[model samples]
Target: MLNSAYLCGMQKYKVHGALTAVGMIYGVNYSIAKEVMPHYIQPFGFTLLRVGAATFLFWCYHFIHGGESIDIKKNLPRLLLCAVLGVSANQLFFLAGLNLTSPINAALIMTVTPVLVLLSSALLLKERVTAKKALGIGLGLSGAVLLVLQQGESTAQGGMLGDILIFLNASSYGLYLVLVRPLMQRYKAATIVKWIFLFGFFMVLPFGWEEFSSTSWQTIPPLIWLAIIYVVVFTTFVAYMLNAWTLRYVNSSVVGIYIYLQPIFASFTAVLLQQDQLTPQKLLFSLLIFSGVYLVSRK
Candidate 1:
């Protein structure tokens, strides 16, 4: 019995570690990705770049590891749906929104994803939202809101339309988490993501091809190119892989709740980079966010 408990604890620790890694990757990506879009590349063009490169990487990873092939006949339809929700629509709206909004606004708005996931899980997966989980989500959200607001008027940099698109992105992602949870149980993460990105590539090609073709690729600086690579490799490929793998060990709600950590990671990065200073107010908000994460993560 003691051995079994120890194994279970270690498994949970690994799952949380993966989720935290994803949070850090995505937290940094908000600024890195935002810096490249709408100037060097339009949102759709950037989406194409991100999805296309990620699709290639996922397939290459699958081949290198000898991952099993998916059942196209039975799973293709579901994979297509996931492509729409998880990849194409999700990425499109996010980049577009980020182009129109400030990075802080984008990160803060994304914190609402856990609430959407909690509600979706109850309605679709029929998963019960215990009172503890609900409270945790509420506290996390409050902290995120306070943090964003305290940043002063600059928080609304992108305006109402951008904010609305960010909300839509969050909604799509939350639903994708619930829907994709079952697929994680049935297939290897690489097999599923590779197929999803393949479908997503075709989906975004129509909207992005013209923008992609028109870009003056020669004018883009090397640093911006590096940012693009980071978005494609770390945020799109590695983060997605980690999120999908973690879902196999925990419920979708637990996966969603980890998003609350993103803003905290983002803030800490700013402090480390000397872009922002740490203050008591920021510390209080961090406490609230961490407390919420703890409550929801309780076994």
Candidate 2:
């Protein structure tokens, strides 16, 4: 028989490894999304492809793993909301925003989602937000503003409409995160994802059909297809699973802190692959945001 002490130690190690893998997966997701955005598909088309492909892959995995199927009759309301918030609206707004704004600008706006979540949780869920939490959120917001200011020239060139769309995306995503947790606790992540995708696919179908009919499918290259697959499988499917798994093990506060890393990873990847320059301002703002998140999480 295995010793209790050895089993506990093994479990602890597994949790840590999972958290690390989650972070890395999230980082790669941002990098891959940024890389693939401009190559083969327009943002709206890309979003549709991503949701469709991921929906298929996730369900296939679910069936293969013998996961329980979602009961539509029992969970219709929750499923509908998840589909609207998490899948259709989130993807649609984010892609539309990207078309209007620079990726860096979009990433900077997304950094505020944790703060939004904290506030929403307090208002809607009655979760306690201590003074320290408020301070941390404030600091994080300041850092985000700095990061955006650092990219002022690009933002100005991108125009105001895109910036507004990006902000909407950020707000919608924050609401989705806060609201989805309870449902996640009650349902299997895979089941939640499958239904969300099904709903999202239908939601986007009318619009997607128009775009689909207009495109010449044969002219697209193999590399473009590969990029779409990467975005669909890794970014959407695997990333969501890792995120759901990590949330089960870690506090939401900790998860909020880790999300700040997305922009930093995106910025670095942009510099390395796309030859985008990183200004001193971005570095400073990033530090400020990290410091804020650290402060908020500290007991």
Candidate 3:
């Protein structure tokens, strides 16, 4: 009984720990990935690199750990859909949007994900949404709108477009969380992600190939190379794996509420790197975002 209890406690710690780590990695990723886009590599090119490299890594890991074959016929269509929403659309929109917007703005905009997830769950998974969750959704939406309004007109077109794309990315991701949950029960996280990346590679290929080919690799500096490596390895490979594993232990909305922590880490990193500022308005908006996610996540 003691051993079983100890294992259960440890398992809980690991699951939550993995989720926290994913948030931190992704928070830092916003700044790191922003530094590489539209200069050293275009968004599409960078996304291709991210998805392609991650696919290779996932496959390599799967091979090393005693190769397991999935029920291809049964799971292929769902896996392909997962690839489109989770890998292709998610990465492509995020990188493209991050390129056009400030890392802080991008991070703040992502705070709507939990709200989106809750709504998606309610609609698709037949999950319940309490009055508190509805209030939370309203709060999150207000925060996103306020953040957009906070931006000056100097870069309105680009910033607005970027914000919209980020919202789309969040929507795709939110729905993905709901859609992928069923598969989580039937397969290992690695198994699901490996196939997702494989299909994602093809889905993104047509869109990203030209930009990827146009990149002048030899002119790139070491720091940019390091950033690129971080995006592919940590942001793409490790983060997805952690999220997939966490889903096996919790609801998709529970997994998504962790996005509330992202802007804190993102702003801190951006400030440290002199990439963005920490203003009072941003703080107030972030509070609303935090409050909303907190309400939505309450049991």
Off by over 4 Å in 3: 1-8, 131-158, 275-299
* Cα lDDT for residue 278, candidate 1: 84
The Cα error of candidate 1 at residue 48, in Å, is 0.2
Instruction: Report lDDT (CA) for all predictions.
Output: 0.86, 0.68, 0.81
State which candidate, 1 or 3, has the greater lDDT: 1
After the best TM-score superposition of candidate 1, give how far the Cα of residue 31 lies from its true spot, in angstroms.
Answer: 1.0
TM-scores across all candidates?
A: 0.95, 0.83, 0.86
Candidate topping TM-score: 1
Per-residue C-alpha lDDT of model 1 across residues 1-299, encoded as one tens digit per residue: 11112337578788778888998899898878877987899999999989999999998998799888667998877888899999989998999888898888998899989999988989998887889988989998898888867866465566788888888999999999989888888888888889889999999999888988999899999999999999999999999999998777777888898898888877887778787888999899989988888888776
Judge candidate 2 against the unseen true structure and give its global Cα lDDT, from 0 to 1: 0.68
Model 3, residue 111: distance off in Å is 1.7
**Clashing residue pairs for model 2:** none
